[model samples]
Target: MKRRNLLIAVILLGAAVIFYRAFGTPDQLATGAAMVNVTVPELSETANEGEAAFNRLCASCHGRNAAGQDGVAPPLIHKIYEPGHHGDASFLLAARNGVRAHHWPFGNMPPVEGITDPEIAEIVVYVRELQRANGIY
Candidate 1:
């Protein structure tokens, strides 16, 4: 019984240390955004086209301003622009393949099939613009 108890304690201690390393301290969470690195290009006509596409397809669930719909989608402004938000690569992957909760909280963003690669690129530009406008940049 003594040996078993010691083993359990050791395991628990190891798990706690691992969790702390992975999650870091509360201070890390508060100031983490400052450590993020993103390279955002200036909005171009491509971004405008993306905005139009969003209005036609994503507006219903994501909202005209990308503020996110209650019980449907999440706001795209603050979360995406904040330095700690996500790297552009993650955003690109999520948009192209439809991510789960890494980006939005509406479950899965089904792969926007019917659209061309250029269109998807445009949409990404528009989303980035929205993020910037919302103070994410």
Candidate 2:
């Protein structure tokens, strides 16, 4: 009987491992935790202004420092957005004209309103600076 019980315990442990692997461990299942802290690098005066503009105009979807928000927008600091792939003009065009959904699951990006070309330039500066700081450049 003791041997049978030990066998049963082993089977149960195996099942638990399988379950954890399939559904993730307890910590991985915790989605309600506070937002993870992300360190944003300091910027030059122009880039700082751009940061403020980004926080006001872009952070809702792009997330602070353009780190990106899941199901909202793709991160600007990612390798896919390297200048060679997505040049500075791409950002301007995206803000001026909404972009079709292609890379990410987050639907199409709508043209930004209430911001001008100069402001967009500032935002680009801020984004590029952040990207550089994070080694995305």
Give the TM-score of each candidate.
0.56, 0.71
Residue-level lDDT tens digits of model 2 in 63-104 = 777877755687887878889899999999999998998877
Across 1-137, the per-residue lDDT of candidate 1 in tens digits comes to: 99999999999999999998667677544321222232344667888788788777666666665666654665555555454656666555755687776553346776655655666667767877767755576
Which consecutive 10 residues in model 1 have the weakest lDDT in total?
Answer: 30-39
Give me the runs in candidate 2 sitting further than 4 Å from their true place. 1-39
Model 1 lDDT vs. the true structure? Answer: 0.64
Runs in model 1 with CA error above 4 Å?
1-44, 80-84, 102-105
Error of 1 at 48 (Å): 1.6
Instruction: Give the Å error, residue 100, model 1.
Output: 2.0
**Residue 130 in model 2: lDDT:** 78
Q: Estimate the lDDT of model 2.
A: 0.80
